[model samples]
Target: MGPAERSVLVAWSTFTTTFTATRAVTHWIRDGHGPASGGITVGGRHFHHYNIGIALLSAVGAVALRGQERHRRHPVTAMAYGAANALIVDELMLLLDLKDVYWAKDGRTSVDAAVGLIGVGGIYLAAAPFWHRAARELASTAVHRPA
Candidate 1:
């Protein structure tokens, strides 16, 4: 209903959509169905989406932290943050292991991580009000109690 809630909903939706789209596009490219059949090669090196994700994440973080409240709460900002988060999460395994294990059996970890994130994100969005109330109550009780 409010700006914060709307932003959260937008972010979650964007994250899920971007994650699905990224996976499909990447798979298509990997299967030699896209223009960049062997992946985007520059200077004889393969370019990975995670790299773009990192950059996008950095930019979003910067804007969120340093920009005005309106900028921070903008739908575009939320979308960017969500999309970047999805991209990074999608390749979490590669970042963790610092290896090109994508498409390998080990790459399954990336999908696992993405799914876990989606689950957790959904839970948070669904229960955030309850959690906020619980936190406030706990804090109030703690402050009033005789320690």
Candidate 2:
């Protein structure tokens, strides 16, 4: 595969892994099965993962846009981008509503959003080669067939 395609595949893999791991860990914590206390806190404010995701995304995006090709296509950069995306998606509902609804019924939208993104990404990656082939085949048939 080309470098760009390889980078995308790496990113997609990272995104899926990060998303799944985040969900599992959060569930464990929420269920009170872990040793750690509640959410991360500095002073009196609770820090959310999405906040980190946004910062990482901004940094990564800037570097990718202005850095050298090698830097932009690096696996590390891809992983960071993927993980950032997952973190943001994991809290989509909260972002939409501007409130903490992580365990509420309204929070289900976050899961739905994550699933939708993962499915779309998976389909695109899996069908990448087929898409080009299908397009070529259709073009050839059109060229040879009567109008």
Candidate 3:
């Protein structure tokens, strides 16, 4: 309802979309169904998705901390943060394994992580108001009720 809550919803949606799209595209390419080009390569080294995610996150943080007031709450920043988070989360297994296993069975870990994040985010958003109300009531009872 409030701006903060709305922003969170938007960010979550963005994250979900980015995560799903990235996974789908990667899987398609891995299955030899997409373009011949595997991915971006620079200077004989392949750039991972997480690398771009990190850069986007850094840019978002820098802009949020140093840019003008109008830039702080911009939707672009929120979307960037979401996409960055997705990219990083999608590579959880790769990071842990320290190798390219994205197309292997182990790669399912990324899907699990992404699904878990979505579930948790949804639960948190849905229950936050109830939690806040309960906390408020508890505080009021502590202050007003006899000891």
lDDT (CA) per prediction: 0.88, 0.89, 0.87
TM-scores of all candidate predictions against the true structure:
0.84, 0.89, 0.88
What's the residue-level lDDT of 134 in candidate 2? 97
Instruction: Give the clash count for each candidate.
Output: 0, 0, 0
Task: Residues 39-127, candidate 2: write the lDDT tens digits.
Answer: 67778898889988899899899887898878999998999999999999999889999999988999999989888888999999999
RMSD, each candidate, Å? Answer: 2.7, 2.1, 1.8
* TM-score attained by model 3: 0.88
Better of 1 and 3 by lDDT: 1
Q: What is the lDDT of residue 75 in candidate 3?
A: 79
Ranking by TM-score: 2, 3, 1
Off by over 4 Å in 1: 130-147
Looking at model 3, which ten-residue stretch has the lowest summed lDDT?
28-37
Model 3 C-alpha lDDT versus the unseen true structure: 0.87
Tell me how far candidate 3 lies from the true structure as C-alpha RMSD in angstroms: 1.8
